[model samples]
Target chain A: MDSMLSTPRAPRIAEQAAQWLEVLQRGGAEERKAFAVWLTESRRHVEEFLFMTAVDRVLEDVDPQQRIDVEHLLTQGAGKVVPLPAERAAAVSAGVDRVEPAGMRRRSVMALTALAAGCAAVAVAAWGLLAGTGWEDYSTVAGEQRTVELEDGSLVYINTLSQLQVRFSETGRDLRLLQGEAMFSVERDPLRPFRVDTGSAVIQAVGTRFNVQRRSRQTTVSVLEGAVRISTEAQTQEEGELVAGPQQSVPDSGMLQAGEEASIVVNGRITRRPIAEVARVEAWRERRLMFRADTLQDIAESFNRYNRSPRIRIEGEQIAARRFTGVFDANDPESLVAFLGAYADLAVDESGDELVVRMK
Target chain B: MQTESSKQTDGLAGTALEKYRKDLHRFLVRRLQHAEDAADLAQEVYLRLLRVENSEWVRKPQAYLYGVAAHVVFEYRMRTEKEPVTFDSEVMEQLAENPAGVQPDELGDRLGLERQLERLLGTLPPTHLAVLLLHKRDGLSYEEVARKLQLSVHTVQKYIFQAKARIRMEWQRQEAQ
Candidate 1:
């Protein structure tokens, strides 16, 4: 039996559950009735519901005994969210210094595992790096761009509101995109297929260069050279179909040709289109964002990627559809918004780090 | 080594009874803040275990024993007044003055969060409370909890779920508040 069908491989359901749990936790009235209805619908729903409920329970029972060090737990986002003071004391009482070795071990293991994931498509021994460490993590706020070099010779240009974990293993290299977009310039090694894991899907290179971007719950893969195979778990080798095309929404098996762009949606739907200009697609490499005719919401979201400051606020559908185009330093999205505000017939106000924009 | 006939031996009784006695006693001592009372409840765990029919029928001895101990603690707390244990004074003194980057506007956020947690914790039933304490406070395994309660692992998990749902309701109330 295909694991996809057997498991009901619906991340949408999981996401829905998480959202409903959040809503219930946050006391959203609309979700309460919906959740109750869903819970009583089936025994399986109740079981699935209970798992997340356990997590919520763990979060609420924040132990004062564990309140020794707020910094470590809060920094790692590891423990349940508690008052800063309690967290700090817990950290101290638990002795954060004692957990350092264990934390390091976990981090190194995670780094190695990420590396192994990269080499999944290609054959490579996992022994070489003995210890994986010292890869700088770079994250851009809503609309920003920065270039970073990995331990391996490859260079990565990160796009707005994006994060990538760089791990170089003896086998090859791996990159996990926690949030945003990145363009990778690979140092070609056919023996070690460079791989990228975004939140939505995983892409393995066939000695090719490509750019992967993760937005919301969608992953966009654009191949610049050779070919890259993208797969969702739903269409993996274990499934009836070994090689899924652009039409298949499964996670483990989709192929993309050079100069082609493909996206895997949140609901496991895939769409592919031919790229008009590779340069436009990889504009972040030169610290530029060319939206052509993109929605204002997308433009604002792109700007939000650059920094926590200069928050973009759009009111209603009236101004959201307004298409934007121009060449601006992706590093400073606020300034771009300010520049656009000058003539776009949009009222813009900059207060501290927040930028509010409304149709004039 | 833990033969049925060896129950009367001082070494076996001391080692077997003392394992959870001190820990359970210590937990009770903290919650009740009365060493004598905690000590009494700890003794009750042994008494209850000894009274179980064909106690030798228990295969997982330690698990069964702890389950009995946890129930005693739960009953003891419920039967007594709720003098909720709080963070120590030294801990409280250190808690003053929020972290450096908390921002001036967020000074009262911690107080609000505490209020929220208090309301949420209040909604859970005593057994669910025991489950929370056993799982979160003591870090007991599901098997241990089930064995102690004379229930299956699924039931223990259900108790945890019930506790969580109640907390979730409290969190919802806090959000509205």
Candidate 2:
């Protein structure tokens, strides 16, 4: 039981589940205390525990007939197919990546299927997501940044704590930004509409790139490169609903053009704005914050997005309102504090979980 | 305990349920394979949110919502615990439409994924599969499985981990596909 928790290659979620199951399987005071702490680490830890419990129950009851069928399929699949040299070369030489041993095995299988299934067996993004097959989910933990490349040649730059599911069907490419922010440099597909959905709003791309940040109240869709159609659920539900928006909301919904940005709020109101502050909006993904003629409060707000501790506070409206402009590492509060101390003749007090500033 | 740092973090992390109702439901729909179940799960999430005594330390509300949604999906699937359940139509259609054999029609792509899952499962050593099947299918606790099979709990757990790992890995591997 103890050894189960330390397995080297188990998926992190399953491994954490093993560790959690071990605690539940064995009852004790110290173990419970530690388990409580782990559970508090994130909502994820709790979900993993529940997931394991369900997976445990479900797999056991997999109908015996189905199990037999699967067993038969496994044996049959071993000698599944012999790929032609041409297909083999396409499988291995073509840019289809084999990053892991499992994928390597599947690539051979994919090669075999491509030859055998013809158009019928074309790999679809729906397969991966539906079955937990090959659909890759890219996410960042707190304060983390990651860049992921999708199978359809699309690139996703995931901002901190963001959850993005990259799903591509034969006819369409879809990215679901579950939370946080992600900038998608979508490769163009004419037949396959590339749609990025942020729950309330769908950013449809004809052939372009954009960013979607799902803040609590408003979802900001910013286009850095090309035009994107930002559609909200209500607008899509009743076209006139947005068309009746005194007139600006509907037409703009068709194309959120390059250098333009729009916010989709909870009430289904669409607010479009030119991305004049592109430098500032684009900086956090690069691990830095750029401010131009922004107030100390605004700078403080930007810094707050990146750090959980050492909060920055300006003393008064005069100090908070003073406009400052600079580029600083997103993770470093001390640098900003030092800069403030020197630039504004302020005193920087670094104590416990906060960095407070006031005029000298 | 409410400090300036906490306020700032709250702004970055707090997720009002209204903001992501559609997204949460959609996630459940994908996983649960039923819109009604997804809606029920979404409402459950909202109720859970309402019951939260302190929203502090509940950082990253969207991630948190999905976390809750994940549990809801698992729980929804598990509602039939110990009852014999066949592979989902999704799973069956996938099996029926596998590329090596027949013309899969519309279901081929999804059912075709069975090849990947089976291939991954087939790679596990027999011992690992046995332990996992016993634990999962027979509903035996690790200790019970170990005792029944005359093996150590450590051995039992190890194989279970291996099987679970393989399934999880294949699912993830497909993510990148």
Candidate 3:
């Protein structure tokens, strides 16, 4: 080769180094011993060996998919004319129902990329998954809030203690709100209805701003800006009859307008509030938790959601029965306790793992 | 001398670096003086050992290894401008073995190597490129590559070597630029 001619002895060492790599990879004890002797001959041998191996590693790091020529050849041999991944992804989002062979192959590749050692491959595929039916699950911790921009240009403001699984099919944008609350600022698409499944019901919207909160006893839907269609799951006739004493009374799921809210219970029935009570419902966003004459125990639980240590515990029936009305910082437990002490004429005790409130 | 299995990043047990790690650590400690800095440099030496593309070049791997460690010490000196460290003549003598200083750039690190590699990989001949891809990307053994390509093992070795040589040429050329 011209390269060998340009550098005569370097090539010889290169071959020698390559041979040693081969031996090191596969050869027995005798060959390895022979290899150790060969390395003793020159300093260049080790350096060249290092050079080859490092470059090889770099090559290994890059995806074979990047080599368009090779991928083209492989695709042809498989008896298929394949479009590039980017092109196929674009077609998919443009409402093309036909799945390209390459697109399907890429889907598996994308899945493998998630689990594979090659992180870069996964990164490449992650961006393309927005167009495909690739469902991605997202969650936020107790004190953390996250905003995710969906492929359909919808923005999901994930609230604390929330888990959501999102899937974008050709016809619709699907979401399953596993727990907690999320405020969605959806982008309007006539072709697709943005839907959230909360086990009890499915809230469908063409484009709207709304919040879905899954509470301890029931799932609540509060519409802040636009109308959302609440379709509760159908309850069985026998179960309904047992609850209603041999009378089947089916409750209808309805749409909630801006400043309207609804709660869906276990039997797939809804309780509607005429007004959303927007300021009270959305107060957590401003860190200004609003409670009106709530029980001391209930208020403590609200404050505890934002605090970690020194849990709030109301002592005695007198302290627990006290009415509390205040807008306090969600994150500031000290301020809320201080407010109770000053205004409610309550004795506050900070001792040994609990913040205790007692009737003074 | 036989070394223990290495605890390096690549996780190949019983590498020469693993066996003689204490010696290498002591060597670094002597020059860097600070136990932590020496410890870091010693780990870097092991990492480099683990990353050795061709294990064959390590004939007098012990000597060749010290050569790498000695060079790392020099590079460490080139950095740490806040510290006025002196390199004795003996240390300077060993520096002659290593001439492959990475090309300088504004980013001053991996970006330069990536640029140089990209340019060089493009310039390499098809045979050399094929061998490089097979050995590096495909992670094929020389015997396997030989079998696949219908060539002798020696010829495959030559291609791998040539591929390496061509890359080195390109890197050196970048340095000259």
Best by TM-score: 3
lDDT of 1 by residue, B52-122 (tens): 56533143333244445445554565566665544344421222221111121121433444455555665
Candidate with the greatest lDDT versus the true structure: 3
Better of 2 and 3 by TM-score: 3
- Runs of candidate 1 with Cα error greater than 4 angstroms are A1-146, A170-172, A234-252, A331-345, B1-177
Per-residue lDDT of model 2, residues B82-153, tens digit only: 544443535323322331221111223323334444555666665566556545433344654555456766
Supply candidate 3's per-residue lDDT for A218.
87
Task: Assess the local accuracy of residue B12 in candidate 3 as a C-alpha lDDT between 0 and 100.
Answer: 34
In model 3, the runs with Cα more than 4 Å from the true position are: A1-135, A234-251, A343-345, B1-177
Could you tell me the TM-score of chain A in candidate 1? 0.54
Screening candidate 3 with a backbone cut-off below 3 angstroms (N, C-alpha, C), the clashing residue pairs are A39-B59, A39-B60, A46-B57, A53-B53, B4-B14, B4-B19, B5-B13, B5-B14, B6-B14, B6-B15
- In model 1, what lDDT does residue B74 have? 47
Q: List the candidates ranked by TM-score, beginning with the highest.
A: 3, 2, 1
A-chain TM-score per prediction? 0.54, 0.54, 0.56
- lDDT, residue A256, model 3: 70
The model with the greater lDDT, 1 or 3, is 3
Task: State each model's TM-score restricted to chain B.
Answer: 0.36, 0.38, 0.50
Tell me the spans in candidate 2 whose CA falls farther than 4 Å from its real position: A1-137, A234-252, A277-281, A314-322, A343-345, B1-177
